[model samples]
Target chain A: MQEIEELAARLRAFAEARDWEQFHTPKNLAMALAGETGELLAEFQWLTPEESATIMESPAGPRVRAELADVFSYLIRLADVLGVDLPQAAHAKIDENERRYDADAYRGSARKAPPLSGA
Target chain B: MQEIEELAARLRAFAEARDWEQFHTPKNLAMALAGETGELLAEFQWLTPEESATIMESPAGPRVRAELADVFSYLIRLADVLGVDLPQAAHAKIDENERRYDADAYRGSARKAPPLSGA
Candidate 1:
């Protein structure tokens, strides 16, 4: 958790050093995340079926990791500036899920959907 | 965007209906999310090579999507409860990525790692 915070701080410092805060508006950040995602996807774009799986840890792994990091960094930044506790929020959502996907219905079944109500 | 909010509202309603708020504490929710994640991974367990990639939209696809949604829903719920604007946070992260993975170093290259500094 502290690592998440430290990572966010490094990103902030990086942004400050570049004097790029003016472009850090929410809309721009979202668009950038989308674009980087595309870049991540691009790594897999045109690879043969075998290539796609093997691509990681070749030249592709680093790009994928970087893109993911990019996605995470600003997410943390926005959370920080907005005053959100990410772990706490992450925990709350899971509780709702247990009820939604009750274990009895899904535990041993290969099926993903819950059983139809009362059937 | 509005759809995201509406979905969050419905989840809250569902939570309220169950009177399960006592168990909705942060720790429980996280454990539930992790458990659901394991269920998702279970779908892929023991599948042949061909089975893994072609699994989507098959019996496996729905399970995968459901698990993904499970992961996402709580993520969104946490954001909603914390009043953090998700899209906004998502956007900001992208801006930071552009500089980190400059196009010149990676464009059209299979290599994912940026060039060695000053080379």
Candidate 2:
């Protein structure tokens, strides 16, 4: 938790020192996050499911990690700008999911939390 | 941090309880994360920049949060499957970015982490 807070502070300091907040409007930050997420997916796009899992053993490993880093960087920045406490928000989400993804109900499915058909 | 880890453990328990590890492979988890990210972006696809920021005030707010939760859910699962420590990885990325995004050199820009032109 301290690490996340500290990292956000450092990033905020960097942004403030240069006054980049004007450009870092919530929309722009969300756009950046979405773009990075796309980049992260691109690194896995052509690979077979097995290949994607083992990507770290291939030449694309570093590329994948770098993209993941980008995704995370933007995630933190977006939360900062929106005043969202990520850890708390994330916890609440999981708590919600606990009921949504009930082990007794959705245990064998790979489908996410979408409502069941005819439910 | 505890919450994140605890949520991961709970998710794992849910998966294990139903023997869904076969579908919880790293590749599959990453794919799910990517798909959710795309869904998140779609929520903002038609909005003007101003509209995007204030989406929470619009009817799309809950949808946006749900999508974000899905993104985070898969992200945590991906890291868990890969044996990656997300907090550490994120910290290292910020440190690396400190050099890459020198406020003195690259302020007022939103070009992401690409290399300089002709550098």
Candidate 3:
């Protein structure tokens, strides 16, 4: 796999080819990502519960898939700029989660945490 | 924020300290991410719609926050291994989205595509 930095370089090259650097500062990139996220959410805006669940698997999936790609793209860029190793961070976070949401208590329930102290 | 690869390196350092490489193959990492995603989804499960929306804003926010961190962690890892510059990818994808889900037809409705030609 290409390292994240290499990927960033490739992206820079692609952007340079198009003279798009002026548009890729962290703030603008972030704004673009938010806009794309909105579009991704919009894909399921009016759909029924069932439709929302299945939309990604349907012919219309392309649209939502594209939007999700948008989300990931910006997320990666954020990582690129910030120097975060996604895989390692992801793995480490899972380890932390194992502690907070032990499987024995968390399996098969939709609840996030155990009840509040009084409730 | 650090660059994605640097973050990966920092993560590697963290993992190495714990000798956790065996557990981080792409397959295992992916499974772990899915599991964590299930947990994040669980946070809102069983709660009334209002409860789910407010849960993140309440004391229980920490729990949901942790789960989200889990999701982003693995996602970053996957991107790291594959060498994708998330920020650039995100930016370009938004440009693509503008074409697919132009705002004029998409503003308030939740529908994805303009209705299918026949339906």
Model 3: share of real contacts kept: 0.09
Please provide, for model 2 over A27-103, each residue's C-alpha lDDT reduced to its tens digit, 9 standing for 90 to 100: 76767777777777787777887887778889987777776766767777766766666666666665675566666
Q: DockQ for each of the predicted structures, in order? A: 0.04, 0.41, 0.08
Ranking by lDDT: 2, 3, 1
Question: Model 1, range B37-83, lDDT digits (tens) per residue?
Answer: 34545665666544544565466555444444554455444445434
Model 2 chain B lowest lDDT segment of ten: B110-119
True contacts kept of 1: 0.01
Per-residue lDDT tens digits for candidate 3, residues B4-117, read 555556545543444454445443443454455456556555666445445646676666555545556654554454345555555455455445554455443334442100
Q: Which pairs clash in model 1?
A: A29-B91, A29-B92, A30-B91, A33-B94, A74-B93, A95-B29, B57-B61
What ordering of candidates by TM-score runs from best to worst?
A: 2, 3, 1
lDDT of 3 by residue, A22-107 (tens): 44544344344445545655665566644544564677666654554555655455445434565555555656644555555544
Give the poorly placed runs of model 1, Cα more than 4 Å off: A1-119, B45-51, B107-119
User: Looking at candidate 2, what is the lDDT of residue A1?
Assistant: 39
For every candidate in turn, the CA RMSD to the true structure comes to: 15.7, 3.9, 12.4
Candidate 1 interface RMSD to the true structure: 15.5
Instruction: Assess the local accuracy of residue A42 in candidate 2 as a C-alpha lDDT between 0 and 100.
Output: 82
Q: What shift in Å separates residue B55 of candidate 3 from its native position after superposition?
A: 1.5
